[model samples]
Target: MTAEVDAYLSALPDDQRAALSDLRARLQILLPDHHEVMSYAMPGFRQPGPKGKMVVGYAAFARHLGLYPHSGTVIPLIDCAPFKTSKSGVLFTPDRPLPDALLSQIIATRQAELAAGYGKR
Candidate 1:
């Protein structure tokens, strides 16, 4: 974990920090091994393939937690009606953490995008 990421999480209120921490743990477990770093001023993971790319990223905000798959292509690929979503990511609250199935789908879709050379820039 990067110091910036630690500081970011550490600065959050306990509930937010805990929620983000849980999300971080889930990402780490689901994605392949990678450098867990601070990217886009947020907690993110970068996989070491095809020139060490960023596979996914996430952050916590005042009202919700944000999960970024790092690709616009992934936004519409998954069904996220249960949560709020935008072109870049999904938003959910701490009290209502994202479901395991949805998380897997997001990560899977991101992985497919990477494998397909879709999100590389």
Candidate 2:
């Protein structure tokens, strides 16, 4: 992680910082095979397999942290509730948090989406 992203995440209130940190840490645990690095001016974790370079690949955004699966199927996972995604994202507000359950779902879905070659990756 870059000092910038670390600083950014660290600067938030303790709860918010912890929320993002927990999500980032969980991503590491869930995607051990993925390449974790700072990309696109954010902390990114890529699939790190034969097709790794296909995408940026996963990034943490300004308010919410997320991944870029490339296939775009991730849209549906957030379409329902707790998340509202546009054609490109899962909208995140500073008020609402990126939940652990949802994080797990996103990780699992990402694994599937990556396997399916969805979005940029």
Candidate 3:
């Protein structure tokens, strides 16, 4: 994890911090080649491509955690019935973190989109 991301998570409440940390670990496993960074004022990952840039991000909020798939188009296409979602991101509470399957699907979809050159940096 980057120092900026560590500092950001350190400031969050315990539950939120733990939730985000777990999510970050899962993401790292799924996208091991991606580099962690601070983007859009949140913890983000950039997969090195012909043009390296942020492919996903996550943030802790007072009421929810955010999973950003970079493009507005991607999150809307995800079947997020179990959780709350908007064009920008998926929202889940600390106590009810996103399931591993759902998180994997979201990351896979975003990875596919990026590979297809659908979402530019």
User: Which one is best on lDDT?
Assistant: 3
Clashing pairs in 3: none
As a whole number from 0 to 100, the lDDT of residue 119 in candidate 2 is 53
Q: Return the clash pairs for model 2, or none.
A: 70-118, 70-119, 70-120, 71-118, 71-119, 72-119
| Candidate 3 local lDDT, 1-121, one digit each (tens) | 7999999999999999999999899989998988998988999899866568578899987788999988888888789888889998999988898899899888888888877887454
Worst 10 residues of 2 by lDDT: 53-62
| Model 2 misplaced regions, further than 4 Å | 1-16, 49-71, 77-80, 93-95, 119-121
lDDT (tens digit, per residue) of candidate 1 on 1-81: 678888999999999899999998888889657888888888899887557778889988778889998888797888898
By the lDDT metric, which is better: model 2 or model 3?
Answer: 3
Query: Distance (Å) between predicted and true CA of 24, model 3?
Result: 0.7
Off by more than 4 A, model 3: none
- TM-score attained by model 3: 0.94
Ranking by TM-score: 3, 1, 2
- Model 2: per-residue Cα lDDT over 47-107, one tens digit each: 6766574332334455564545444566565533756665544555446755667766766
C-alpha-based local distance difference test score of model 3: 0.88
Candidate 2 local lDDT, residue 9: 72
